[model samples]
Target: MNHMLLTVRQDANLTDNLVGVNAMEVLINALIKSGAQRSSLRAKAFGGARMVDGLSDIGEANAQFTLDFLESEGITCDGHSFGGTNARNIRFWPATGRVLQRMSTDRLIEPKTIVQAPPEGNDLELF
Candidate 1:
C-alpha cells in the first residue's frame, strides 16, 4: 500500500526561497495531481525547535511560515506542535489518520531540586 508522509525543514531562504511559496505550491500541486482536492486539504505541522544554542533561532520562523502558507491556501491545520527547546519523536499512521508525539527537552533538569524562598530578605543569592 502506498502512503504519504511529510517532513519539512527549512533553515533559511537560500536558493531563491525554497521555504516559501514556491515549495508550498509544488507540494500542493502534487497532492492535487494525486487526486486530493484542494478544498479538502489538511495538515499537521511538527518538528520546529531551537535544536542548538548561541545561534539564530529559525525554527519558530519555519513553523510560522508553514502555518501561514497553509492558511493562505485555505488549508486546515488541525494539529501542530512547534517552537520549543525540546526534541520530539513523532509517529503517524496515515491509514488510520492517527498521530503520536513524544517531546524531551535537551536541558538536564533534576526534579528533586526544589526552590525555596530565601530568608525573606532583599539580598538575593545566585545558584
Candidate 2:
C-alpha cells in the first residue's frame, strides 16, 4: 500500500491555509472519496521550518498540530522531520514510503525579482 505525505504547517502570520490545522481532515476526506479504507491509511510528514528571522516559531506549532491531528484520527505517523531553522527540500517515494530530506542554507527572506506585466492590449504607443 502506498503512503501519503502531508506537509502541513502554521503560517507565520497564523493564517488558516491549506497546510494548517485542517490538513489531516482534508486528506482523510480525499482518501475516502478515492476508495481508500481508513484502516489501511497512514501518514508521513515533513517540513515546518523556522526559516524566517525575528519571528515567532510557527514551525514548532505546525509540527505539534500535525502530531496531534494524526493522533486524533488514529493514523500512525510512521516518520517525520519537523521544526528547525533551515529550509528543507523533500523527495518522497509513495511506493515504498521513503523520504529524502535535504536542508538548505537559504533564508526565507531572500531577495526576489519582481516582474510587472503591462496591462492587456495596452502597448506603449508613443506618438
Candidate 3:
C-alpha cells in the first residue's frame, strides 16, 4: 500500500496562503479530492503541543478543530496524540490513518506521554 505523509506547521501563512485556505479545511478537502471515502478513510491527528505555559490553549484549539472537522465530515479518526507542554515529532501514514507521536522535552516543560490508541475496525465509526 502506498502512503502519503503531510505536515502542518503552526504558521498561518504556511497553511492559509500556501494551501489557499486553513490547514484543517485544506486537509479535509484534500482527503476527499484524493479519493478517500468517508467510511474507508481514517484520520490520525498529531501536534498541537503547547510548549509554552500561557499558550496552551492554542494546542487545545488546534486539536479540537481537527476533531470537529473530522467528525463533521464523517471521517473516522483512527488515532490521535495532542495537547502538551512539549512539542512532538509525529509520523502519519495517510492511507491507514496510522500515527506515531514522539514528545520532545528538551527545554521547556514536563515530560510528555502518548495520548491515543489506534482504531480497531471499520465499525469504530466517527459519525
Alpha-carbon local distance difference test for all models: 0.69, 0.76, 0.59
Cα lDDT tens digits, model 2, 55-113, are: 78787777877787788778889999898778778898877888898999876774456
Candidate 2 TM-score, true structure as reference: 0.73
Task: List runs of model 3 lying over 4 Å from the truth.
Answer: 1-25, 109-127
Better structure of 1 and 2 per TM-score:
2
Best by TM-score: 2
Q: After superposition, how far is residue 16 of candidate 3 from its true place, in Å?
A: 7.7
Alpha carbon deviation, residue 117, candidate 3 (Å) = 52
CA error at residue 104 for candidate 3, angstroms: 0.9
Candidates sorted by TM-score, descending order? 2, 1, 3
TM-score of 1: 0.68
* Backbone collisions counted per model: 0, 0, 0
Q: Please, what are the lDDT tens digits per residue for candidate 1 over residues 14-87?
A: 54345467877887789779887777777777867776665576777777777877787777877788867777
Q: How many backbone clashes does candidate 1 have?
A: 0
Reference-based lDDT, residue 54, model 2: 71
Better of 2 and 3 by TM-score: 2
